[model samples]
Target: MIRAFANPHRFMALSRWLAPACLGVGALLMVWSVWQGLWVVPHDDYQGGDIMRAMFVHVPSAWLAMASYMGLAATGLIWFVWRHELADMAAKSIAPLGAAYTAMCLATGSIWGKPTWGTWWLWDDARMMSVLVMFFLFLGYMALRAAMETRQKAARAGAILAMVGAVNVPLIKFSVDIWSSIHQDASVLRLDGPAMPPVYLTPLLIGGLAHMIFFAGLTMMLMRAEVWGRRGDVLIARKLSGA
Candidate 1:
């Protein structure tokens, strides 16, 4: 299936149909989830009812932030090994998306922390620092790509950085388990069960799926734009050389 879709034209055609559908469904799901999470679901017993609700957005964003970077790193590896233009473009396109999610994670985390942890921020936590490192990795990839003159060189360098930075992803996931941090341990991904109630869990799952779809749509759009821009540049260069 992957090999079948390796052709750019086929991929683009599929994207054209899939992107809009994903976006529409994602938007609807997100709105529904937010409504359910905020109004329909019962409040937490311990934390102020409304405050715990932020998990609907915060947790998913944090998960995606890490997931997106891992995707970028994987694409970067493909680009470096196969010298695939599409893979390189994908890596470039995903950087900002990863960064945006990372930022959302941190902001929502801080908001959640202020009431829960009694502080807006903390340095002692490994998870927090790991997230910060992921953010910097996104920034570093974008900056390095932008600064380089040639696309190939930029992609190569960025790929190296991405792969190196991927080490922090595992650290972020395992941080709570590894250290005696204030951050709560795994709830959603636990072996036994999720701690959240059914009402809250329903919306959380809905919102998370919505966010993933939204990210896919956005990444496809950005990749298409980058591919088009690069093709245009090539055309312009050819024209100038011919003239």
Candidate 2:
């Protein structure tokens, strides 16, 4: 499947309808999850009353932030090893979208924290600090690529940074467990299964699925744009050279 999609034509053809279908379905799921979270689900006094509703947005963003980075890293590694230009395109496309989700995670986290932790930022919290590091890693990946002189150079630089920065993803995931932090630990994903009750858990899971599907649609859309842009560049170069 991976090798099949390595051919840009196949990917473009497949994504044409798949992307829109994913977008439509994901949008519907997102709307339903949001409605359930905000209006249908009963508030949990143990967590933070209605404020727990933010989990629908924050948790999914956080999940996507980490997942997107891993996707970037995996594609980067593929390009680094196999010299696949499509993989490089994928890595490039994932970066900005990953950064956007990371930013959303950080902003929403701060909002949730201010009310619960009584502070907008926590300098010492391991999970918070690790996630912050991951955010910077995303920014640095983009900045490093932009600084390179050529597309090849940019992809090479970005791939190396992504592979190295992947160390942070695990750190972010385990930070809460490894260190003492105010943040709750593994409410949804746990060895013993989710600690959250059904009412809150169901919608939260749906929200996470919605975001994941939505992210996939967005990534495919961005990759499609990159493909078209690259084609345009090729045409411009050919015309300039009278090829």
Candidate 3:
């Protein structure tokens, strides 16, 4: 099945239909979740009233920041082992989106921290450092890919870097527990289950799904663009060579 759809034409056909559907669903869910979170959900007991509402966007963006890197790393693995151009293109295309999400995570986290933690920044926290590392990894991957002259060489190098940098993903997830940090401990994925009430949780889950769908849609669109552009370059080169 993977081999069958590895062809650029087949992938483009699938993405055309799938991308629009995901975009529509994602937009609807985002609207509904934002509305519910801002109005229907009760304010937090400790933090300033209504300020905790940022969680709807912040948490989901953070989830996407990490998830996008994982997706990129997996695509890198496929590209490295299978020598699939489509997979390589997809990984390259997702780097910017992943970096954007990571930046959003840091920005929103700082905003949330200001009111809740009484400070906008902290250096000693392992989780914070891990997030920063994630951001740097994304930047490094993009820079290294762009630095190489040939596409093949760049892809190979980028894939190796992406796979290596993925080690930080696990570190980011467990950093709060692994070391003392100012950041709050895990709440959503704890063994004991969610700490928040259902009212807040309902909107959070909805927002998270919305972000995932959005990421998928965006990634597909970028992948399609990369595929088309690369094919065009190949054809141009072939024609010029024949001439």
Candidate with top TM-score is: 2
Q: Please list the residue runs of candidate 2 whose C-alpha ends up more than 4 Å from where it truly belongs after superposition.
A: 168-194
RMSD of 1: 3.6
| Candidate 3 structure quality by residue, lDDT tens digits, 126-227 | 656677888999999999999999999999999999888886567665864465444454322121243677888889999999999988998888888887
lDDT of 1 by residue, 6-108 (tens): 5678768888888788888888998999888788888874654578888889878988997899899999888778777778878888999999999999998
For model 3, what is the error of residue 219's alpha carbon versus the real structure, in angstroms, after optimal superposition?
Answer: 0.5
The parts of candidate 3 lying over 4 Å away from their true place are: 168-194, 238-243
What would the TM-scores of all predictions be? 0.88, 0.89, 0.88
CA RMSD, predictions in order: 3.6, 3.7, 3.5
Worst 10 residues of 1 by lDDT: 185-194
Candidate 2 local accuracy as lDDT? 0.84
Question: Which stretches of candidate 1 lie above 4 Å from their native place?
Answer: 171-194
What's the candidate order when arranged by decreasing lDDT? 2, 3, 1
lDDT of 2 at 153: 95
* Residue 162, model 1: Cα distance from true site in angstroms: 1.1
Superposition error at 19 for model 1 (Å): 1.6
Count of backbone clashes for each model?
Answer: 0, 0, 0
Candidate models: Cα lDDT each: 0.81, 0.84, 0.83
Question: Which residue pairs collide in model 3, if any?
Answer: none
